[model samples]
Target: MRFTIGKLAKATDVLVTTIRYYESIGLLDEPDRSESGQRLYTEDAVERLAFIRHARDLGFPVETIRELIALQVDPGQDCERVDEIARHQLGEVQRRIAQLKSLETELKRMLSSCEAGKIASCSVLAALGHHEGCLHDEHGGQEVLAKPPSI
Candidate 1:
């Protein structure tokens, strides 16, 4: 059964633009076009898109996903490469977790330093003004900001 791009997107829970981008980048195969020029997709396309979506949800990079797809094309190949990719992704996740923990620790320390006094005397402000006050020096480079504590 052939499906249009919209149907494929709905089936795979991927955006139409993402599907197009995947095709443009050779992640997804160029699908057959209908008589009027509408893109036609088969069950294979739907399955491939689902695989890509699941890999993305797991935080696998596009290049890694592409490598994985290539691996899939030859089922007889050993899975050592797949294991290596998974291990690399796991290491990256662990590194991010460590960084996030440091950021959390620093943010908590900063909040505890706030004496609930006037802003002029706020340790939080002073800490923000001077990174030297941070308990975790490595937290400075993270882009994620902790939410303000409740009053």
Candidate 2:
């Protein structure tokens, strides 16, 4: 069955705009157009879109996905390259998890020490105000902010 972009987005839990953006970047090939010029997607197209979205959800960039798609097309080729890509992505995910755990520790320390004291003299403020220091290092880790930025 053919699907329109809206239907594809709903089925895949990806935004319509993101699907179009992927097409723009060549990560997803543009779908065929009907006589009315409406884009028509086949089952294969939908599956490919799902694959692209899944890879993006796992933090793989479009460029890498493009390569993976090519590797997927050539049946004679070994899938070892795909495994390497997955391994790299896994390593990256693990690194982020570790960084988040470290930041969580620092945040717990900062929050518990506050003691509900005056805002100006709060331990939370003291922790944040330390020059040249943070739960995340100057360069390493997720660098979580103590608070969200003002809108």
Candidate 3:
């Protein structure tokens, strides 16, 4: 059955803009257009979009997802590269978890030191004011006081 872009988005539970982005990035194939110019998708598109969605949900980067898709074209290819990609992603997840745990510890320390006093005497504020008060020197190399881009 053919599906319009809206129907495809609804079936995949993905945003229409996201679908268009995937197409633009070569992650998803462009759909056929009717004489009146409506996009027409097929079951193949539905399945491919689902795969992409699942990969994205798992925090797979788009370039990595592209590599995975390229590997899919070879039916007789060995599965080593797929295994490596999954393992690398797992490592990244582990690293983020560790960073979060450190942040949690720091936040708890700051809160615990709070004496229910005024903002001037607040330990949390003190920590924010003085980065030396932080238990960790760095949070995954993130800035101690990051500056926002100029609007």
Candidate 4:
């Protein structure tokens, strides 16, 4: 059965703007327009949107998802390609986990160093202002006081 954009969004639990953005980005196909200009979708769109949502939830980038969709369309493609993508994503996740763990350790050290004194004597503030004074030598003498952006 045909469904409008709103219905599709409701059924897929995705926002209407996200759906439109996906279409604009070539991740989702442009649906048929109704007589009054409403977009009409079908079961295929629902299934595709679900796949997209699942990939997104798994942290796959849009470009990677586009490659996966291309592979899905071609039954002859080797499964190795998909495996490679997943493996790369796994490596990235591992790297981020390592970074987060380091951050946690550094935060703990800073917090523990605090003696409940005024801000002038706060170890946390001191560490923040002077990265060289960090307890750990993980950065090999380089400053790493600021948190890195998420991957």
Clashes in model 2: which pairs?
none
RMSD in Å for candidate 1, one decimal? 5.4
Candidate 3 residue-wise lDDT, 50-146, digit = tens: 9999988777888999999999999798999999999999997788778878888988998999899897788888898998879899766363233
How should the candidates be ordered by TM-score, best one leading? 3, 1, 4, 2
**lDDT values for all models:** 0.85, 0.76, 0.86, 0.83
Candidate 1 lDDT by residue in tens digits, 40-131: 99999999999998888777878999999999989998999999999999997787778888887887988987899998999988998998
- What TM-score, over all chains together, does every model reach? 0.88, 0.84, 0.91, 0.85
lDDT of 2 by residue, 1-151 (tens): 9888888887877778887887888877889988999887788877888888777767786789899998987899888989999999899778767777887787787898878968878888888888344655642443432232211
Off by over 4 Å in 3: 141-151
Model 1 quality (TM-score):
0.88
Model 4 alpha-carbon miss at residue 86, Å:
0.7
Choose the strongest candidate by lDDT: 3
Task: Name the TM-score of candidate 3.
Answer: 0.91
Q: Which runs in model 2 stand beyond 4 Å of their true positions?
A: 131-151
Separate clash counts for every candidate: 0, 0, 0, 0
Query: Higher TM-score: candidate 2 or 3?
Result: 3
